[model samples]
Target chain A: MSPVETGRRGAAPDPSFAPEPAGAVPVIVSRDLTVGYKLHRERKRLTALRDISLSVNAGEFVVLVGPSGCGKTTFINAIAGLVQPWEGSIEVNGRPVTGPGPDRAMVFQDYALMPWRTVESNIRMPFELQKLGLSKQEIDARVRRYIDLVDLTGFEKSFPYELSGGMKQRVGIARALVSEPDILLADEPFAAIDAMTREAMQGELERFVAKTGQTVVFITHSIDEAITLGDRVVVISYRPGQIKEVVDVNLPRPRFDYDVKSLPEYSELRDHIWRLVKDEALQTAHGAK
Target chain B: MSTPDLSDGGSISEATDPNRIEDTEWTAGEAWERYGSKVVTVINLTIFFIVWELFARSGAINQLFLPTASNMFLALWDGFTTTAPPGAVISGSIRDHLLYSLTNLSIGLFIACVIGIPAGLLMGGSKYVEKILSPYVWALASLPRIALVPLFILFLGFTVKMQITIIALSAVFPIIINAWAGVKTTDESLLAAARVFGASRAELYVKVVLPFTLPFIISGIQQGIGRGLIGVVIAEIFGGSKGLGYLITRAADTFNSALLYAVLLLLVIVSLTLIQITRSLEAYVAPWRRVDKV
Candidate 1:
C-alpha cells in the first residue's frame, strides 16, 4: 500500500493504538543528569552537563537544540546508555540504562551505516544483532516493509557509498526503525544533508512519529527544524550545558507543509528558542575560550 | 561545436562510419595492441638468453667455472634424463632434491602463519601487550636471520627439523609485526560504532578487525614466505643429506660448476613461481586496490 494510505490508517484513532499498560511506560526519564569528561594533561575535571532533569512521555517528539559542544550529544549518549551520567540516573521504560541496549536505537550524526553493507543489509543490522530465531523469509519480509516505509524500495542492494547524503540518512532512519525501539534518539541526523533534502526528511520524520507513535529525541542546530518537528523543544545552554527552557509546541495535529512555518504559533516558538540560543551561538563566535 | 580532435588515428573507430559516429566502437588493431606487451616480454627474454650464451662461449671467464646458458639447461636435463657416469651416482637427483627443499619450505611457512597471526592480534589488541612485545619483535625482525643456520642445526640436530626450524624462525617476525600493526592501526571510530551496536568481543575481532587488517597480513605472509625459503636453503647447505641446497654444496665442493649452475637455475624458477603466485593472490584478495584491474 502507498505511504499516505498507510499513514492515514496508522494515525487514525484506533482503539488498539492506545498504550498497553503492562509493557508501555514513559519512553525516557532522566533525573538530574550530569555528564563530565576528564580534561587533558593537566588532569582537571571538565563537567559537560549539570543537573539536567527531563522526561519524554511515550510518543512525544522532543528536540534538543543548542550551540556546538553544548553537551547535547553527551545527553543523548546517556539516554542511549553509551555515556554514564556522573550524577543522575536515566531510565528507559523504568529500567535504568547500564550500557547500550537494543530497546533504544541511536541515529548518529554521521549516519553510522557500515560502509561494507548494502542499504538493505544496513537496515537489517539490528535483526542480526538480535539473533532472532526467525526464518530468513520472515527477516526479509520485515526488511522489505521498513525499506518501503522510508521510500527506499529499489535501492536495497546499493551500498552506502552509492547513495546521496540524504539517502544515507534515510537508510540510517530505516535502520533505527527496523529495530522497533520505543525511543529513537537522533544526534543531528539531518544536519549533514543538504537544505532541500533536510526539509524533506524533517517532514518525513514528522509523519513517521505521528504514524508510529514512537517517542523521538532529535538534536539539531536549526531553529525552524526545532520548532517544526518537536512536540516540545528543549533549549540547552553553552558548555557545561543545562536545560535553558522547555517550550511546548502546541501547534495543531497533522502539521501541513503550507501552514507549518506560516503559523503565528510557529513564529512565536521560533523567536522564543532564538532568544535562548542566540547569545550562546554569539558566545561561540566571539571566541569564548 | 566543431568536432574536437578525436583525430590521432585513434583506432576506436566510430569516426570511420558517419551513421555509427555517435556509437562506441572497438578497432581490431586496438585489441591486438593490448596484447602486444606480453609478446614484447617474450622477445626480451629471448634476447637476454642469446646475449648470456654468446658471452659465456667467448670465454670471458674460465669455461669450467662459467657454463653457457644452454649448457646449464642441458645439465639440468641430463640430471633428470641421463644416467650418471660409470661408478659415480649423483648424491640425489634434481627432482628428489627439489621436492625435499619444497616440502621443508611449505611446512615451515604453514607453521609460521599458524603462530604469527594470533600473536600479532594479541599484541595489537592491548597496549600492555604491545609495550611488552614491541622491543622483542623489533629486535628479532632486525637480526640477520641467515647467520642463525649453524645455531638452528646445533639446537635441533642436523635434520629436516633443523631446516624447518630455521625457516619458521626467519619468517615468523614479519607476519607477526605486520599483523599487529595492521590491527593496531584499524579505525577507532569503526570499532566504537561496532561497540555501540552491541557487538560481542569475538564479533569485533572476526568481523571488524580481521577484514581491515587482511591486506597487511597478506603482505607479511608473502615477505615471510620469501624469507623462509632463503632460510631453508641456508640451513640445508650447512647440513643436509637430500635437497637442492645439498646438491649445490656438493657440486661447489667438487668444482662441478655446470651442475651447480643448473641447480641454481631450478631454484630461481621455483622462487619466481612462488612470488608470482603470492602477487596474484594479493591482487585477487584486494580488488578494492584501484590499480589492480583484474
Candidate 2:
C-alpha cells in the first residue's frame, strides 16, 4: 500500500506524466458494450447503455458523472457481473466476466445493509456467502479492522435502522471493504447522506481506498463529488449512455487535505465538466431522449 | 487568564462526562403524558358501570333482557371460580366452556399454520403454483366463512372435529395470502445486495427472503386468530354440546342475561389478549418494522 502511495505521490508534481502510467495493467476493460432491460409490458427492449468502451487501471479511481437515467449504474453493474451485455464484452483481469465473484464488491447507494443483522454480522456476510479460504481468526480480525477503519467500532452491535444515514453507509463501506476485493464499485453511495457528512465520508473513502489500493468505479450525479474523488472523470451522455469525455485529474494526492477546491485549475475542470453535462441534464429534465 | 482556564476546563469536563447523562426525574405533566390514557380509561369504565347499575335499578327495561352490572360481575366471578359437577348436563361454568373453545382454537390454528405457511411460500416461490392455486384460494377466501360452517357440521356432525375444521378453513386464507405477499414484495434492493455479495439462489431464500417474511407471517397469524375465533363461535352456535357459544345459547334460552353478558365480556378479553400476544411476537421478531410502522 505504501509503495503504490509513494509512487503516485512522487509522480503527482510532474504535469507531463501520463494519467495511465507505462506498464500499468488495466483491471476492468469494456468494449462496445450494449446493455438494457426488457419492457415486458410494452413488448420492447429499452436500451440503457449503447456501444460503450472504457478501461480502468489497477488502483485508479474512476468516477462516472451523468444525468439521471444515463445508464451510469448499468456500466458498473455490467462490470460487477450483475447484468449481462446484449452486445460486446466486459473483461476483468483478462477474463470475460460471468458472475459476481469474491474478487469484486459493491457499496450500494441505499446502504443495503440487512436490517435484521448487526453491523458486525453485515460485515461478516461476504465471508459466509463466498468461501475465501480464510480461517476463523483471520475473518474475525479482518471484520474488526474494517469496523475500526470505517469509524464504526462502537456500533458493531447496532442494526441498520438504529443508525443514521452516514453511519449506515459506513457499515455498508465496511462490509464491502472487508472482503479485500480487487475492485470496489460504488453507486452514488453518498447521495443519500447529508452534505456535511457526505464531504467527510468522501475524504474517509479516499483514505480507505488509498490504504487498500483497490481500483474504484464510482458513479455520482454531483460534479464536485466526481472531481473531488476521481483520478479520471468520465462524463456520460443521457438516455443510451455513451462516454462523452474522460478528463484526467492531475490534482495532488488527497484533495481534501490539499484544499484543492480553492485552486484555479479545480474551478476550470468543474466548469468544463459542467458545460459538457449541461445539455444532457436539460434533456433529462425535459423528459426527452 | 486563570479564571478563563478554570471555566474552560469545567465546561470541557461537563461535556465529556458520561455520568452527566443520568436520567432525570419526571415532572407531574411528564408522568401524565406517559400514562394519562390508562387513568382516563379506568375512571371512564367505573362511571359507565355506575350508570349501568343505576339504570338497571330503575327497572325501565325488563330484567330478563337487561341485567345489573353488579349481577353480571357476580355471574362472571362465579362462573370462573366454580366448575360443573362430573357427568353433569349443560355445564354452568364458563371456565369449562372457555377452555374447550380455546383448545379447539389452538389446534385449528396449528393446523392452519402447518398448511398455510408452506403453501403460501410455494405459491410465492413458483409462478406455476401461484397460477394454479390462486383462483381457488380467492374463491374460498371471498365466500363468507359462516356459509361453510353448516356444511362442515353436516359432513362431520356436531363434534369437535367439525368445529376445528371450520376454524382451520376460516383461518388459513389470511395466513397464505400474507405469506405470499411477503415473499412477492421482498425488497428488490435487498435481493440485489444479496446477489452482489455472492448469495446463491437457495441462500437468497433462506437468508434474505425468510427473515424478511417472519413478521409478515406473524401478523398473518394474528388475523387468522381473529377469523378462527369467529369460526369457533359460528360452528358452536350452529350445533355443539360444549363451548362459549353453547353457553351463550343456553343462558339466552333460560333468560339468564347476567351469564350471557359475562360470556360476551370473556370473548372480548380473549380476542384482545390473543391479538396483543401476536403483536408483541411480531415486534420481537422484526424490531426494524416496528419503528417504520410508527
Per DockQ, the best of the predicted structures is: 2
Every model: iRMSD? 15.4, 8.7
In model 2, which residue pairs have backbone atoms overlapping below 3 Å? none
RMSD of candidates 1 onward, in order: 10.1, 5.7
Task: Please give, for residues A1-289, the per-residue lDDT of candidate 2 as tens digits.
Answer: 0111111322443232224456777888888899999999999999999988888888889899999999999899999899998999899999999988888999999998899999999999999999999999999998987776676766688888988888888888888888999999999999998898888777767756665578999999899999898988999999899888888877876676667899898999999999999989998988863
CAPRI grade of model 2: acceptable
State in Å the error of residue A7, model 1.
22
Tell me what TM-score chain A of model 2 achieves: 0.93
Minimal lDDT window, size 10, model 1 chain B? B9-18
Model 1 residue runs over 4 Å out of place are A1-25, A38-46, A114-121, A131-137, A150-170, A190-199, A221-228, A232-238, A244-256, A259-289, B1-94, B126-132, B210-216, B237-294
Per model, kept true contacts as a fraction are: 0.12, 0.37
Rate residue B240 of model 2 by lDDT: 92
DockQ (Cα-based) per candidate? Answer: 0.09, 0.30
